[model samples]
Target: MSEGSVRFDSDALQQRILALRGERVMVDSDLAELYGVEARVLNQAVKRNAERFPVDFSFVLTKEEKQEVITKCDHLQRLKFSPHLPRVFTEHGAIMVASVLNSPRAVEMSVFVVRAFVRLRQVLVEHPDLAERLDELEARVARHDNTLSTLVATIRQMATAPTAPSRQIGFVVDPLEKKE
Candidate 1:
């Protein structure tokens, strides 16, 4: 293939990287597409060289996670009915896949993939304030959540609690009373 055909946009690659299980990962299908191979082919290669990919490097999504990805990612809607769960590769795992594939396209695209991950990390480092602000916002939300939960619990208790009997408002006469 010509160099022009192998061109990749870092932004496009970064978009494919997702946060799953507290780590940045690219779906196997996305990597396969980038590397010019079928998803199953890539997975088969990974399986053949399983030692190269540790748990931290790659993992298959659970049923609930697969459903969640399908629900959230419009592109992954195709995977909704797929019998096999999709595998996700971390930054290191992507490099490992490139080595395993040993294809010119895979090697070329792996550089772009690494850059995309680095660019994402740079973004966070460049704007520490954004992360700090997010943390503050999360703390505020947590406090509000606690307050709301307490309020709801109090309301529920009040609703379920027994109430005391009320005294009669009008004057009462004793039974069998003699008139003066």
Candidate 2:
């Protein structure tokens, strides 16, 4: 790439990093692009240090979740990994990733990502109504889930129960006929 193009890409990437602030967490591919490395390389590093990440620290997106993101984020759609599913990093995972990568951009981007996560949390703290809505939604979902479980159990029992025997003439098979 030419110097001008490089600068343009750098500026665009910087703006992206900034936009990612507050509530939006970057996926592995996005971070890799900003850090100038292949996405798989970053994923391999994370895989190597699996013990450092619990589910909350890093988790793969379900197919439906990935599709929802694709629908929401325009820039995310331009990513080469549109078809490649990604794993998300929590604030702590982002910091830990920077430490392992040992690159200047990784370090710099990690600072931004961590700050963004913090900013998002701060915003949520300031919005009690949003929190309340989230709580109500969660409780509603839980109730529905419980009801669904009971319904499923009842359906299963009904299906498994033996039906009444039909009152019809039937032939009796010899014991030897049951054998192969």
Candidate 3:
């Protein structure tokens, strides 16, 4: 297929990619929509090319996880209502689907899927260091709070401390000016 035969919409594809089980994945239904095919057809292709997809490439969601996904993502309400659990395709798996389907639209849209995955990976890698830094800062701050509280108490005590008696400067000093 020619590059300009059809334009791929990366933005739309990006929205379909989701984070689950510490990896980004797209459900079969979303991929089918992107490739202009039905979900069953896509699943059939995956089944036919089973060797191409390993566990890392794709996995079926567990019942508990499926419930959590349904609870968290309103867009996946179809998954909630559907009797069968949905399978998710990771970045590599999504690209492999293109080769399996062997359609021009699938080939073109696969490029978009790959790009979306790349963008998602870049964002994940770039932003997580800050979260780690934030966690470290919070721990350090918690430790410092104990030290700070003690230091503040000591300062308050010093502020209210008693003054020592001073020696007379000279023999001519006024006795009346001094407290006995």
Say which candidate scores most in TM-score: 1
- Best lDDT goes to which candidate? 1
Count of backbone clashes, every candidate in sequence? 0, 0, 0
TM-score: model 3 vs. ground truth: 0.66
Error of 3 at 25 (Å): 0.6
| Better candidate number, 2 or 3, judged by TM-score | 3
lDDT of 2 by residue, 78-151 (tens): 54366667787766777888877888777776666665567666776899699689779979999999999999
TM-score for every candidate vs. truth? Answer: 0.72, 0.56, 0.66
lDDT of 3 by residue, 1-180 (tens): 454654445666677777788788988888888888899999998998899999999999989878977887777898877988899999899889988999989888888788788887787688998757867997999899999999999999999999898877867766679676
List lDDT for all candidates, in order.
0.90, 0.69, 0.84
Better of 1 and 3 by TM-score: 1
RMSD of 2: 10.6
Pairwise TM-score winner, candidates 1 and 2: 1
Q: For residues 1-180, what per-residue lDDT tens digits would candidate 1 score against the true structure? A: 354765457777777788888899999999999999999999999999999999999999999888878887888888987899999999999999999999988998888888889999999899989878977997999999999999999999999999999999998998889999
State which candidate, 1 or 3, has the greater lDDT: 1
lDDT of the structure predicted as candidate 3: 0.84
